[model samples]
Target: MTDCLFCRIIAGELPSKQRHSSDLVIAIEDIAPQAPLHLLILPREHIGSAADLRDTPAHAALLARMHAVAAELANEAGYGDRGWRLVSNVGVEG
Candidate 1:
């Protein structure tokens, strides 16, 4: 995971405009934004995709936390009334 771009950002090996961070996840502004309030919420630990998540409480909580953070960011960015879309993507193919 050391070679991962998001991991690098999480590890402080690269710079990112972080919006929120916690023990389980991190939220950073998308470098190539598609919306006025675009952001990428990622896990602190590297996982290729949702398929990589374990069917456990910790992993479940991670997903919940990610969504929670996204909602917080969207509302903060004034997208609460307009709503927001959450696209989950990862890796090159993703």
Candidate 2:
């Protein structure tokens, strides 16, 4: 976990310009955004990557909630109709 950058962010050891945070996750605007509107969403739990997910039922619901959160944010920013992309970084695929 010491090697995890997200863990450091959640711990406030690493400086991130955070946008929002809830009990489960934290949302931050990407420092070097790919799009005009880009956000980095991460969970508080230390899940290594997509391969780390074991398809647990709880994880399914959690992912759904995370997507919903992103959707809500996009809609609020008037980007829902403009369209957007949610990228979950999974190891080298990121």
Candidate 3:
């Protein structure tokens, strides 16, 4: 996991334009944003992707928290009323 880009960012080994941070997740501004407000919400835990999460109560709770944090960030960034997109890229092609 030392080679994981996000893990390095979460560990403060890499510099990121961080917007929000909490015990569960951290939101960082996208380096190459496709939209006016593009933020990448990352869990502190080193999960490969959403597909990596098992169907368990703990994973469910973590997913919920991630969504809540996204919503909060969108609202704070003035995109709540206009809405925004949440995306996850999977695999190498993604």
| TM-scores, all models, native as reference | 0.90, 0.88, 0.93
Each model's lDDT: 0.89, 0.83, 0.90
- Which digits, one per residue and each the tens of the lDDT, describe model 2 over residues 1-94? 4989889988999899887788778888887988987888888888888778778887887787788889988998899898988877778857
Model 2 misplaced stretches (Cα beyond 4 Å): none
Which 10 consecutive positions of candidate 2 have the poorest summed lDDT?
Answer: 85-94
lDDT of 3: 0.90
**Which candidate tops lDDT?**
3
Q: Arrange candidates by TM-score, descending.
A: 3, 1, 2
Give me the displacement of residue 28 in model 1, in angstroms.
0.4
Ranking by lDDT: 3, 1, 2
Which is the winner by TM-score between candidate 2 and candidate 3? 3
* Clashing pairs for predicted structure model 1, backbone only: none
* Candidate 1 total steric clashes: 0
Please, what are the lDDT tens digits per residue for candidate 3 over residues 1-94? 4999999999999999998899888999999999999999999999997778898998888789889999999999899999888888877787
RMSD of 1: 1.6
The segments of candidate 3 whose C-alpha lies over 4 angstroms from its true place after superposition are none
